[model samples]
Target: MEDAMQFAPSENPALATYSPEVRQQLFRFVLQLADTSLILGHRLSEWCGHGPILEQDLAMANIALDLLGETRSLYQYAAELEGQGRTEDDLAYLRSATEYRNPLLVEQPNGDFADTVVRQFLFDNFHYHFLKQLVNNADERLAAIAEKSLKEATYHLKWSSEWVIRLGDGTEESHRRVEKSIAELWRFSGELTIPTALEKELQTIGLIPEYADIQASMTAHAERVMEEASLVIPQQVFMLTGGKDGRHTEHLGYILTELQYMQRTYPGMTW
Candidate 1:
């Protein structure tokens, strides 16, 4: 299975036929996917030894690992598509906060446990459907990466869904906390499926799925989960933008400070 999942150069013949403009757009699309996972994974990893319970600590850590692994694979493929000499580390660690294409939702600080869970649930709901559509991407290598990542994403969705239900339907305090978290985080969710110019280009070329289709699927899934959890979906408000275009919130700067510290200090030092 590991060997079968290995990306071969021949898998993406479409790249050879594409114009340079199309190739650059595809590269940006891939980075958007990778950056989201990388930032979210780093956020989750901050909970390593701080989960409310031992089981949760381990679970969060494992999920973080899964996300980071996905980021590595996606970034590696993105680098290859760029056909430059940029390594995955360069893509992952060298970029400034203003250059990251992750949705603002993922880069937001993980507040309380409820806040973290709600954030994960919101993103996981969208991620599951997004990957489902991506599995059929016109780019075979992208599809292959999505196919593998989808398995982990399935587990992630289930885990987050169960937690959201557990918290939302639990005691009065738990319910209130998750509800509050939902309201606070809901604004960021809109950016997840709002198509950017690069994303639109990929959609036009059939290399990526339509944002509207993914948004519909995500909305249905989220509605069902929120219903089961006895939670209400907040009405849409003014949505925040610019994360996809490299403008991020102030929080991302601190995240980058911590995340890139070692790489920046040591340059290329590897164990």
Candidate 2:
């Protein structure tokens, strides 16, 4: 059997037992989750020295580091599950833009302090629900990792939500900026709740929760936070989606170029 921290292919002959379509769906879903964490962490790392305040600078950088660490575990587990002789570094830094499975929200530029807060706010809420569901994922190791990660994600959501409230109610200028950021970013959020066909299958089989249930929990939590902050939720219904199907913005290429620079240049040199 695979150890708690290691997944050996032979142990899960179930990998071979499952249909090719099911295997592919599971692999793609894992890759998408890992890619989202990796990209978002990279984006947040860009704010290390540029946050609005010294305290916020430290806070954002800490969260960025935590996200990168999470990405490492996710990528490592993915590579092992795929058994393709690929390291986490190879899977992460070596992938082409079109191969990346991160959602569009994480790839969007961090425009300003308010923009960053709102972006984190939306994603943190989504992560909270996603991780909660994954805590009981049919795959044992994946479920264990998700259970551990839920703790870290919970703190992130709490801290970011506080900032959302503070920025939204702090001052006229702050309120206007955060409100605008929320409005601009709301369209990207619908995708988080819209499960793919594979997701539906998993949910029906008890591998995951229904998307509607997750969305309802998320909406209740989000509305409560917004209400406490005296902020109104944006009423946008139109949404854009494509990340799940391998479409990405041009910005990802540049980001990948930078992320992969050392690895591509140095090949196998390790410290």
Best by lDDT: 1
lDDT (10s digit) by residue, model 1, range 116-191: 9999998898889989998998788888888888999999999999999999999999999999999889889888
Scored against the true structure, residue 227 in model 2 reaches a CA lDDT of: 89
How many pairs in model 1 have backbone atoms within 3 A of each other, for residues 3 or more apart or on separate chains, i.e. clashes? 0
- What lDDT score is found at residue 203 in candidate 2? 68
All candidates' TM-scores?
0.96, 0.91
Candidate 2, overall lDDT?
A: 0.80
What is the Å distance of residue 89 in model 1 from its true position? 0.5
Best candidate (score: TM-score): 1
Per-model tally of clashing residue pairs: 0, 0
Q: Point out where model 2 deviates above 4 Å.
A: 1-17
Q: Model 2 over residues 137-239: C-alpha lDDT tens digits?
A: 7776567668867887898999989988998879999889988898888888877778777677766766566778788889998998898777888785688
Candidate 1: C-alpha lDDT: 0.88
